[model samples]
Target: MEFRHLGRSGLLVSEISYGNWITHGSQVEEDAALACVRAALDVGITTFDTADVYAGTKAEAVLGRALKGERRAGLEIFTKVYWPTGPGRNDRGLSRKHILESIDGSLSRLGTDYVDLYQAHRFDHSTPLEETMVAFADVVRAGKAHYIGVSEWTADQLREGHALATELRIPFVSSQPQYSMLWRVIEDEVVPTSEELGISQIVWSPIAQGVLTGKYLPGQPPPDGSRATDENGGRFMQRLMSDEVLSRVQQLKPLAEQAGLTMAQLAVAWVLQNTNVASAIVGATRPEQVLDNAKASGVKLDADLLKAIDEILEPVAERDPARTYETSPKERP
Candidate 1:
């Protein structure tokens, strides 16, 4: 697997990282999850991303069990905070109290002393930015986190956070956002800003939540056991199942066929086309899925193929324009 710097931080991560999101604790059994993790490791995927809120906080525990003993030391683990873990108000957000408490819980669940990257799952509007930054700085100083990052933050928020981290001498190494052929919102501002600030962009849902995998057809029923079947699957994903998007995805199949690659591989390679992207965090339910995704790491997309893909998914605008910017210290660049 090719390695890239996690922003300007000196830490190198695999271009295609493994992530436990909707599949680990909820969709797949423990043994299946363990098999997937092992398969990822065998293929040189060293970076693993998870969130405290995924699968009701059980995802980290499953990962910890899977990576117990010496296996834990061989990988760079990343997890996020800010989503509500319980009914109590104190169970969420980037407040000093919440961040301190959440990190301890994450460490205990992951069976690790420090996370390679600790990200804010989303901007917390209720808390002060300075308070959150100071708390993150304290965690870095205490060695509970190796680097800090944020997910789905806007350009202005990233700039402010970078400024604060610069003034405080804390390193903000990466930013996580939803980016793919089906969703190109970050290209307008987030991508350019991160490139300028020397922050690596780790993208999630690079396949548009499996819409680009060619499994979902324009007029057919949702595939069995897909994320679209989940109760929380929102309108954005519903739109992804539309005839227009499926037609666009179909247009790319010929390209993948010509390249001797799977549709999923083409989708992933398309995401890694940008040099600013450090890694694309992909989730898998089976060992073969992990292996399939690993193929994308080595599949280089030629200029002609890229132009074809852009033409197929043209009129390229932000998928979710309703998501506006919110300021917070947990936000990163």
Candidate 2:
């Protein structure tokens, strides 16, 4: 797989990194999860992204077991905080107590002493930004994590956070956001601001949660066992399952053929086209799916095709810049 520097940092991550969000420890059984992880490593993927809130934190344990024998120095493992991992009040948010304590639990679950990157899963509205950043600084200083990043944070929030990281001498090197052909909310503002601050995006849902793969037909019931059919995961995907969006996505199949890529590869490559995107995080249920996605690594799409894609999907896509902040919880969940 092709590798690119994650933001302005010297660290390089796979162009298409393996992420276990809905699959590991929930949708897929442990054996299937292990097979997918092996498929990723077989295709040269060295970066893995998970979260403490994913599958109630069981995703990390499964991932740890999957990568048990690999050399730790050769992999870049990432996990996040700020979501409720337990029933207690201290079990969530970016407060000093939570951040400090959460990192230890994450490390233990991930079977590693330190994570390559530790991210705030979301902006903590109740906690002071200084408290959060200072906690992150402590995480880096104590060698619990090598870098700090945040997910789904607004442009203004990124600017403020970056400033705090600079003041604290922490490496705030990456932004994790939901980005895809169907989601352009980050392009108008976050991309420019992150560029100025030297932060690159490690985008999730590059395929628009599989909508871009053309598997969901317009006005039709979602296929059996699809993400849209899963009660828990389906909710997040309902917004994009509309007939208008599905019809528009279906229009891209010919473009994929024109580019000699499968619909999924086309979708994955489309995100990496952006210079500010360091990696596109992909999750899968089977080894074949992982293999197909890894092929998108170095494929380059011409400007004409990209323009055609925009013309087809932009009208149906979510581009309102404020939608970024709107997606973040009004208060911590």
Candidate 3:
């Protein structure tokens, strides 16, 4: 597997990392999840990304147990905070209490004393940025986490947080955003800001929620057991499941053939072409899927193929950075 440094930090992660967002606890059985993890390891994937809010906080436990016997020093395990993990008033957000309390719970669930990286799942508009950064600093000082990151954050929010992270002298090294051939929201602002601040993007949904896989054929029912058909796991994918999007995706199969890549590999490789992207996070329910995605690591697409992809997908691609997230005052746990 090819590896790259996480931002300007001294840590290197596999270019194609494994992520269990909707698969570990909600979409697959424990044995299946464990099998996928093993497949990732067998194929040389050393990075795994999960979030505290994924599968109602059960994904972390499954991933923790799956990697129970692996050498911890050889893996880069990452998880995020700032989401409601419990029904309490102080169980969420980037507040000092929440970050402090949440880290202990995460560590306990993951069976690890520290995570390689702990990210803020979202910008907590309700919490003071100072309180949040100080809490992160404490976590690093206490050896609970090695570095900090943010997910789906606007460029402005990232700049604000980076300023505080620098002031506190914390290692803010990564940004996790949903980036793909069809999702260019991060390219305009987030990428530029991250380039300026020494942060690398660990992008999720590099296949645009499987649309780029060319499995959801146009004018047909989504394949059974596909992400677009799963009730709980498919909610966020509805936006990309439109007929227009599916039709556009179908047109990419010939390009994949010409490039000697599967549609999924093309999609993942497309994201990695950006120098600022440290890794592309791929989720899988089957072991073979992991194997397919891992091959995208070192595959380089020529300039003509890339231009063809843009021409075919640009009309339907979502590029408005503002659509990435909506931030405002709200109660966060």
Candidate 4:
């Protein structure tokens, strides 16, 4: 696998990182999850991303077991905070109490003393930004995490957070955004802001949650056992399952053939075409999927094919920078 520096930091991560979002503890059986993780490592993937909120925090434990014997120094493990991981008032958000308690729980579940990157899963509207940043600073100072990052945060949020992180002398180095050929929301603003702030984007859903793989047919029922058929894990994918989006995605199959790649590889490589993307995070339930996605590393697509893809997906792609995220009112702490 090809490697790149995560943002401007000295730390390097595999360009195609393995992420267990929906499949680790909820979507698939433990044996399948372990096999997939083994496949990723066999293919030279050294970066793994998970979240405490994923599968009600069971994903981290599953991942911890999968990586139990691996050398810690050779892997870049990333996890996130925020989102309700428990039922109590202090169970979520980026509040100082939540951050402190959450990190310890995450480390315990992940079976690691420290994570390479600890991220805010979302901008905490309820907590003061200073409180969150200071908590993150404490996390770093305590050696629980090497760097800080935020996921799906707006450009404005990133700028303010980075300023505070700088003031606190924290190594804030990455942004985990939902970027793909079909989701261009980050391109208009977040990419530029991240570039300026030395924050590289480790994009999730590079295949538009598998829509770009051409597996879902237009106006047809979703295949059995696919993400769209999952109750707990497919909520975010519902938006892109429309006939219009599926039809547009189907048009890219020929382009994948033209590029000498499978539809999934083509989709993954398409996201890496952007210079600001440090890595594309992919989740898999099968070992074959892991093997297919890892090949996306170092596969360069010509400008002409990229233009053709844009033309095909233009009508259906979500490009508005305003679509970054839903600003839910701060949950009562």
Candidate 5:
């Protein structure tokens, strides 16, 4: 697997990393989860991403169980905070109280003394950004977290946070965002800003929550055991399986065929095309899925093939002109 520098930090992560978003605790059993982790390691994936809110905090526990004993030292584990772990109001956000308490809980659950990287799951509009940054800095100083990051943060927020980290003498190494073939919003603002700020962009949902994998076709019934079949799968996504998106996916099938790769592999390769992207965090339920996603690391898309993909996706871009427009036009222009 190809390794890239995670922003300006000395750290380097594999091009394709493994994550437990909706699969570790909610969907797959322990044995299956262990097998998937093993597959990722076998393919040279050193980073594993998890979040405290995923599966109501059970995902971390499952990951801890999987990485128990000698195997834990061989991996770089990353997890996030800022989501409610319980019904209580104190259980969520990046408040100093929550941030202070949450990292300890995550440490205990993950069966590790420290995480390689700790991220804020989202911008905490309620708390002062300084408060949150100081709390994260404390963790780093205390040896509970090695590096700090934020997820789904706006350009302004990221800039402010970076300034705060510098003032506090804390190093913020990365940012995680939902980026995929179907969602290119980050390219307009987040990508460029991250590149400028020397923050690594470790993207999640690189497959558009499985939309680009060609699993849900237009007019077809939802596949058995798919994420769409879950109770939390809202009506919006259920209705999103439109003829247009599926047709676009169908058009791209031959491109994958010519490359001697699966559509899923092509989808992943497409996400990693951006040089600014440090890593793409892929979620997998089975060992084979891990193996399949890892294959994308080996399949390089040339400039011509990337142009072809852009052409194929142009129709979808036209449909959502607002999203296609950059929110930060000043940065773009």
Candidate 6:
């Protein structure tokens, strides 16, 4: 697999990292999840990303069990905070109490003392920025985390957090956002700001919630058991599941054939083409899906093919810079 540095840090992560967001403990059984993890390892993917809120905290435990035998030094495991993991008032947000306690819970559940990178899943409007950054710095000083990152943050938020991290002398190395051919919200602002500040993007949903896979056909009830039918992830796919979007996505089949890539591979490869993207996170319910996505890690698309992809998908793509602001929770959950 091809590897790239995470932002400006010396740490290198696989270009195609494995992540378990919707399919780990909730959608797939333990055995299936374990097999997918094994498939990722067999194909040379060494990075895994998860969030504390995913599947009610079961995702982290499942991933922890799946990686039990591997040498810890060889893998880069990442997790995030800033979501409601319990019913208590203080169980959520980036407050110092939460981050400090949350890190320990994550470490114990993951069967590791420290995560390679710990991220804020979303910006906590309720918490003071300085308070949050200081908590993160403490986590690093305590050896509970090696680096810090934020997800779905706007350019201004990134700039604000980056400055505080610099002041604290901590490694704020990565940004996690949803990026794909169909979702271009991060392009106009976040990309430029992150590039300027030396923060690389570890993008999720590179296939636009499976819309770019070309499986959800236009004018047809989605094929059985597809993401459209999934209760857990279906709500997030609503923005991309329109007939117009599906029709446009269908037009890319020929381009996929011409480029000699599966639609999914083409989608994943498209995100890696952006120089500021350090990695693209892929999640799978089956082992073969992992094998197929790993191949996209090192594939390079030519300029003409890229232009063709843009032409076909541009009409349906969401490029508004304001969309990034809409992604974050307005209030801490």
**Per-residue CA lDDT of candidate 1, range 1-333, in tens?**
989999888899999999998887888899999999999988999999998998999999999888787465668999999988877868888899989999999999999999989998887778888888889999899999989999988888788888888888888989998888988777878888999998989999888888889988877888877778876543448767778778778878888999889998988998898888999999888899889989899678899888888878885335443243522344321
| lDDT scores of the candidates, listed in order | 0.85, 0.95, 0.93, 0.93, 0.83, 0.94
Clash list (residue pairs), candidate 5: none
What TM-score does each of the candidates earn? 0.94, 0.99, 0.98, 0.98, 0.93, 0.99
- Candidate 5 lDDT, 1-333, residue by residue in tens: 988888898888889999998788878798899999889888899999999988989999999888887466567889999878977788888889888899999999999999989998887767888999999999999999989998877767789999999999988979887777777777777777888889988998787667778888877877998877776543325434678877887788888888788888888888788888889999888899989999888567888888888899777632232342332222201
Give the C-alpha lDDT of model 1: 0.85
Candidate 3, 12-118: lDDT as tens digits: 99999999999999999999999999999999999999989899999999999999999999999999998889998888888999999989988998999999999
Candidate 4 regions with alpha-carbon error over 4 angstroms: 327-333
Looking at model 1, the pairs that clash are none
Give one clash count per candidate, in the order shown. 0, 0, 3, 0, 0, 0
Query: Which one wins by lDDT: 2 or 5?
Result: 2
Worst 10 residues of 1 by lDDT: 324-333
lDDT by residue for model 4 over 1-333, one digit each (tens)? Answer: 899998889999999999999899999999999999999999999999999999999999999999999999999999999989989988989999999999999999999999999999988888999999999999999999999999989999999999999999999999998988888999989999999999999999998888888999987898999988898657888889889989888889888998899999999998898989999999998999999999999999998998999899899888999887653334643
Report RMSD (Å) for each prediction in the order shown. Answer: 2.8, 0.7, 1.2, 1.2, 4.1, 0.7
CA deviation > 4 Å runs, candidate 5: 71-73, 233-240, 317-333
Models sorted by lDDT, best on top? 2, 6, 4, 3, 1, 5
Q: Is candidate 1 or candidate 3 better by TM-score?
A: 3
Weakest lDDT window of 10 consecutive positions for candidate 6 = 219-228
